[model samples]
Target: MTYRTSLTALALTLAGLVAHPSPAVALSSVQWKSCPAYSDEVIRSLRVTEEQVPAFRTLMKRLECGTVSVPLNHRDPGGRKIDIAVTRLAATDGSRRLGAIAVLPGGPGNSGYLDPILRSALRNKEMAGLNERYDIIGFDPRGVGYSTKAACPLSPMGPQEPGTMTKETARKIYDSQVATNQKCGRSDPAFLGQLTTANVAKDLDLVRAALGERTLNLLGFSWGTYLGMVYRSEFPEHTGRAFLDSVAPPWTRLDRHTKDAAAAAERNFGRMATWLARRDELYGLGATARQVREEVARLVGAYDKSPKTFAGLQRPIDGSAVADLAKLNSTEWVRAGKALAELRTTTGTTAPPTVKELLGAPMMGTPVPGAPETLNMTMNLAVACNEDAGRTGFDTAWRAHQRLVTRHPATGRGWGLGVRCAGWPLPVQETTLRRGGGSLVLAGHLHEFMSVYDWTLQTRRAVGGTVYTIADDVHVSATRVPECAADVVRYFDTGRIGSGCAGVALPS
Candidate 1:
């Protein structure tokens, strides 16, 4: 799914999150079990269906495909079974195969099944070099994408009617959100317990065994960094090369996350405002950058009364949503700016489509980690409640938010003191995720409000790796920045971690 941008307030608010509990010591020896027994004619069964057989054949022509069944519980050799799905785009130069490279996507929930195809489109010389020698492997992790998945009905967290929830109303809504998460936990007792980094790392091991590889190379992003870290710690012998971009450290606190995101997003929004103003001729929102800021402020203020409606649906165009839209690279900004300006400038008598209606389809296959179409509140609450060890309450969140909003009004009101994930019911996982290894590269840009540099810094510390600070103002570096991209492709291809990589320097 397309990733969601971090709200500026989320960055600031989340910055305070303390390091998670010290993780359990890595497990030695995964009690290996034979693949789940299935009909030997499983392939034959697929082939028996005329249309399905041809589709499988077409898939095989492009890539080698396979399924490896794993124990639902790694601790129990004999337990309920789940199959992990894997696909590979083999090295084109058949004779010069280096080994297997696993693409670890972000979200702690996003799938990596399409990275091989996505990387193929890059056509960079360095990426081409890796393509020539390595079979890029993409797999959907347990509860994500095409893997053994989990679903919660939308009835619990459905969208509100426009003007139904003000900031005060949102707090009340969050009470039910907390209950919904607690209920989801009760609904799916088994899967919820098994979603930790350690379990996922072990899942990687099963995939490694199935692929018949002694060592596996990893490429991880966002939350995927922790997955790789855990994998490395548990099976150092199985580790090969690893490259992490937009790193999420194992020890970030909610408070620290909130602070960093808020500060960074405030700046990113300003940058976005400038970019928007530059094309004022098209968007016509403002004649200059300062004017653009005024225009954006006007939009936010206007939305407070009633969100702008695009089509028939309501739009929760909150601060984070706005910050997310700003983080798009320059190319996307122009089109987004035009749309945003028109939406903001239009009168209430005429409305644009709600964000939900405009983006009717699921957001998939893009750099943003969370699925924009999925219920945001659900995922935010689920993951945060699961990951947050913080013991603070909604009242605490509200008080803190008031302080921030009072200070930075324009961006603050949207994020300032919002009680989205503060009311989670489950106890946070108390594991500090540091994986010691050699030559891991942590990369992130300055202004990724969602996956901020703090995450990168924390991940670098945890993995005993170096940080590659991008000289750009956007987030999701590997896909956006050129120099950072080159360094990543080089590291993956040759396992070279550059030394003394510097942050963006001020001009002389």
Candidate 2:
């Protein structure tokens, strides 16, 4: 599985940013030390907070945190420096050790510094073998964590914004995002643009050197899966066994990705409708799936024309609020369905506390400057805006949103009404993948809304891999559930995926 990035071509295309020739000696070896205890404020404030911190602390005491010095610009190795923060959990049984595997965090910006310590805790049994047999390493990619932060105000993720996706609101959102893009880019586009996946892959290889390891095995979830593929393409020789959970279709277009996600959301909602219809006696949603769908749509449309205030909500429950709930995962369908049913027929001035609690932020305040979560918000947009090459034109985005919401009302409004990365100063950098690798195993969920099943096939078409399907409708469940994790453990242990691995941890 030699995947050398069409080196000849990438070398030229990348010019200075990637595909280096006669490259300077890669940086290796970090100065390791006991990790300092991160404050609970910092931990809890993180966008992807690991809540089991109190439990992970038992193993956290054994963790080592350090920094490996790399070039701010890979092409200019001797210029200013960047420190990639890392955490390592050495093998408990060195005599039986295989090798090291770097655990890449998912968010383009989420901190991975704590991943090795937290993910390998005794409670996270899926990673037990990795903890015992090899050095499990985690790192904060450049522009994240202690590495460096791209300081830019970020638009809130999910349905954090209020209001319906009318042409007026859509156009306004698009304009504002475009403005934000122009302003954020001017804060050192040349330097910030270097924070691409290709560069991160280079950082990973350097991290490999730091460990004195010849080959690195891998395990990545969600967006982490995408990063692993890029690493494989860049340095396949150094990549050993890789288990990519929730494979992101290498189709790198943000518009396409989000649009597809909306479709998945709609499909999952339909499944929920069927489930709710069967329990009509309890939910009183409807006797049939079609009627349930219609009732849900009618409720959402009413909110579109006239939003209403529940007893405890800081803001009114608008169409977007109801529409946003349309994309619940299979696990949340029951709770969300019950919430929706109450809203449709409620005679009280109060709404369901659970739903209101779930809609935690009706009036989002300004992001706290210097908060731990700030790093994520800034970097996610900076990295996405830096890479996405799509339509920034307001007219196109408006027309697309109108068409989509009309067709898939439950999911369409959530797709796009804003021009993402509009007027970003950085030139778009592109990547090409060639299919030949087979050391990779991809995990796919049959009806999961996020990273739908088709994307798994799409990714496999680009690079060869064995895939096992989860007979559930949840995202990234393979490595988390005992039955599904069997395949992953087997792949890492024997360099082969196990067959007939079954079941996921479905909630009662």
Candidate 3:
């Protein structure tokens, strides 16, 4: 998945701040135990197949699962306590082990627990080297994953179809979001107040203490990079070597981030067009980048006029859905082009299975099984709505949306942080711009759709660090690119990372 697609889904799905120094909570002792069995629903949600369940379970058996109690309100440690679920894969070479390395997942709500296991299962050789020397830790932040969860009444409104929502429709959607917020606030004001990035950073320090680590090595991706930065700022003395991949800009507001994302989407879409044109013999979309883009525009217009209903799709396919298909990774461009070609032929034509599956994945709806009912959405909203330095009013959001649409018509409608958080209840938490002068490394793709290259430059300025650039359109480094992966491991092993790991060229 491209960073844009994942972030867009997260924007459509989850929905959070900072505050004054709270009384520090000492990390209580924890007893490690065997990981509990995962339900079929949870396994499927994790994208683990039923056939791999046994192996997954065996891997889980080797790991330890535990919980650490932390204050519900950091300001008052003696107040209500909440459990933070944690998992650890011990170092294989305990004799040569270094300190703990925590893997923070992207979504403010994404489970950190699965990353270590997933990396091990994939036999990520670079990560394997780090695993040999460091205890890989994963933990769900408060109100996420296996930790104490916060619930909210489901919003009746869904994401408005791109380019289709009018003033009245947008207002109704905004109203529904406010209603959902109102309901949640009424139920648990304290819990809602505490779900900020600063709190999560504090919780992480507690986790580090529980693991008996004086200093923490960090591997944070996407939003995790933001969390890692927070940790670096908060506990500079305790931060060890850190790798922040697909970094979020340290000072960019949510609205600016959205705008930057839209601009990046436009650039990435052009790159996709170039890639697709080179493969015209296979996909038959167009002969040049311009032609391919024109063809896409034509198709979008036609589909918007008369939406098509593919077999098994709950709703008819519209221009917004077709445009969104382009928002995927470059690897999926050919498939998306082919899918678009098939859809343009006949309204009744059944979409290719791949296309159907991609399109059928719910963009907005109820939370999936085994996922927290509202934590993901609520936390995202809480952090974004609170930490943002710009206006959070509906008018500002609507205007920004309009500007984004005007500038990048292809994937603009789904770009900005919508008006749902316009009237968020939490007080704005000023973002702290400090960074730990540790051995830090940040990486980004030149054509990254979500965390754009500009963010890397901004982050480098905000936090002194060396940047490893991948000249292609990949989202997070160290995931698919071997060079990037090796650089990450190399940095962790020896506090030095070489620059200029050329990006892999997309296959034509």
lDDT of 1 at 205: 83
lDDT by residue for model 2 over 1-508, one digit each (tens)?
Answer: 0123354643343355533432675556797766766565554554334766565556677788888888767777777677888888888889988888788777778777777765544435776766778788888888887786667644443333456666676666766776677566655554576877778778888888887888888888777888888888877888888888778888667777767877787887888888888889988889999988888888778777777777877756777777777777777776787778767776676867666766656444554445433236567776777668674587777776777788886655545564777776556776666553338888777778678878988888888887877777777777667766656666777887664244554444
lDDT of 1 by residue, 377-426 (tens): 23334554566655356667666666665454346554534444454434
lDDT of each: 0.59, 0.72, 0.73
Per-structure clash totals for the candidates: 45, 1, 9
Question: Candidate 1 — worst ten consecutive residues by lDDT sum?
Answer: 367-376
lDDT of 3 by residue, 22-49 (tens): 7657668766666767676766566577
List the lowest-lDDT window of 10 residues for candidate 3.
9-18
In model 3, which runs have C-alpha deviations exceeding 4 angstroms? 1-18, 39-45, 49-55, 120-123, 158-163, 347-349, 352-354, 364-375, 503-505
Model 3, position 315, has a per-residue lDDT of 60
Q: What is the lDDT of residue 351 in candidate 1?
A: 43
Lowest summed lDDT window (length 10), candidate 2: 1-10
User: On a 0 to 100 scale, what is the lDDT of residue 441 in model 2?
Assistant: 83
Q: What is the lDDT, from 0 to 100, of the residue 411 in candidate 3? A: 67
Q: What TM-score do all the candidates reach, one by one?
A: 0.74, 0.89, 0.89
